[model samples]
Target: MEKIKISKDEVTHVAHLARLEFGEAETEKFTAQLNGILRYMDKLNEVDTNGVEPVTHAIARKNAFREDAVNASLPPEASLANAPESRGGCFLVPKVIE
Candidate 1:
């Protein structure tokens, strides 16, 4: 017989922490499913990964983005062109906080 990885009480506790409501049948089902997943992970641990390089993505891809370039800064006049109210060199707005 295989040893169970997660118990019913532990599943119930986890459900409570997640604010989830479940019946006895649902709890039992979740316990079995979680145990199955853990057992598969345990099986995966048996594989020897001595000299394998970890990869971020499964497929190769090119950088589909434009190169960054330096640009001239916008003048105060151009920046405040569309402003409803500009005081000195900035936009003026109603007071939000007291």
Candidate 2:
């Protein structure tokens, strides 16, 4: 398997793009961590997966729902009765300034 090499320059570039400011110590730490992760991924790639089906889910699943049906709702007057203010058969609120 090919080895992964994460350089300090690449780490610094990534940090800049992510709006991060890291010191030299953090850059070195992250470079080592990222390289280790890449190595693990490389090891995983060595596994034989020929003829294996790609999985979308691990467990059997079904839509657990009932058919949609119209339900009774309160009349407009009752629905808006609790509002602090109402205008033209609709609830009103203070205007927001943007």
Candidate with best TM-score:
1
Q: What is the per-residue lDDT of model 1 for residues 14-54, given as tens digits with 9 covering 90 to 100?
A: 89999997899999899999998989899768889889888
lDDT values for all models: 0.90, 0.86
In candidate 1 the C-alpha lDDT for residue 45 amounts to: 81
Q: How many residue pairs clash in all the candidates, one count each? A: 0, 0
**Candidate 2: 10-residue stretch with minimal lDDT:** 1-10
Instruction: Compare the candidates by lDDT and give the number of the best one.
Output: 1
Q: Per-residue CA lDDT of candidate 2, range 1-98, in tens?
A: 54656678988998899999789898889998998887777776788999999888899588978769888899999999999999989999898886
- lDDT of candidate 1? 0.90
TM-score of every candidate relative to the true structure: 0.45, 0.43
Model 1 clash pairs are: none
